[model samples]
Target: MTEVLFYHLQNMALESVLPPLLEKSLERGWRVVVQSTSEERADALDAHLWTYRDDSFLPHATWRVADAADQPIILAIEEGNPNRAQVRFLVDSAAVPADADGYERMVLVFNGDDADALAAARAAWTDCKARGFTATYWQTDERGRWQRKN
Candidate 1:
């Protein structure tokens, strides 16, 4: 069973929060896939990943680009994983299919301020629980660090 992680974004934007998680995953030798609801979102994330921090480098590519399998991180609007990622990050309420065995873990990041996003996350969490996947809820602390809520 795939581990489902729900990140409730309260104090920061997705761009601000994503890089560190990606970095940690890379440190663990896990290739990553970031999925969004549209091409524009994926493109924006692809651009952001390049310049998110001046000191660090995240080698990533959009799905439309060539040599996708060579990238450590692949951003896409589609569900396909070209990089053979071990972990997946689903942003902006991106839907997760019923069978998610391709990846070892799935991370769902949803904005707390957006009602629709929260609702979708809630629904996904419930579905994941019903499907017998191990689900965890994480929220930011006062210092803006992630703390497991449930």
Candidate 2:
């Protein structure tokens, strides 16, 4: 069964939070696909990942790249997994894809301060549970450490 995780971001920006998670995913030897809500967002994420940290590097490309299959991470605005990733990260209120179960894990990263994002994350949580996926919720503590809530 696919393990679904909901990451609620309250005081942090996605740009600050995502790179480390992506790096950790790579450390686990998991290929990743980050699905955003728009082409512009995807492009921005692609660029950010490349320069997020001076001491780090993430091997990635956009879905439009000819060698997408060869990348460890791929930024996309749609459902298909062009990179054959084992994990998928959904950002910017991106919906849970219909093909959610195709991956080993699905992560929904939402802005807690955004009303629409909170609502969408709630709905996605319900949907994942109904589909029998092992869904878990996580929130950052006062010091920005992730603590699993449920």
Candidate 3:
């Protein structure tokens, strides 16, 4: 079973989607491990989650690009998922939380219809993949929905 962190809303803003998704995941039936930029998002989703007391938030520390060993996977989600990770995640994608999990081999998504941003993002995804990680295009529909390239 794949653990998924679904980030969605009528408007798709962090403030709008984070709370309800947390609540939905906490019905006590889902066993998905979520990671967000901070515990604030987690706490906002579920009160039982590990959050910092008095507003500090349950974060070990933020991740920095300075550490070469732990590079992040890149994904451009049509609609990003919710996260409550204890560390700050660096993002280059418009979808803040990336996917359910970062990939050892990335399954990159692109809007081939866009023609320009697609080309650039594809290049970036390719560079990461070339370093022994997997990369390929998952073309999107006209409304920016994902349909894996078969």
Number of the predicted model whose TM-score against the real structure is largest: 2
Q: Model 1 shows how many backbone clashes?
A: 0
Global lDDT of model 3: 0.32
lDDT tens per residue, model 2, 1-150: 999999999978999999999989999999999999999999999889889989987899999999999999999999999989999999999999999999899999999999999999999999999999999999988888999995
Ranking by lDDT: 2, 1, 3
Model 2 compared with the native: what TM-score? 0.98
2 or 3, greater by TM-score: 2
Listed in order, each prediction's TM-score against the native is 0.96, 0.98, 0.28
Cα lDDT tens digits, model 3, 22-70, are 3443343332233333445434433432342354332211222243123
List runs of model 2 lying over 4 Å from the truth: none
lDDT of 1 at 6: 94
> Which residue ranges in model 1 land beyond 4 Å of their true spot?
none
lDDT per model vs. reference? 0.90, 0.93, 0.32
lDDT of 1 by residue, 68-107 (tens): 9999998988788899899999999998864466678999
Q: Which candidate do you rate higher for TM-score, 1 or 3?
A: 1
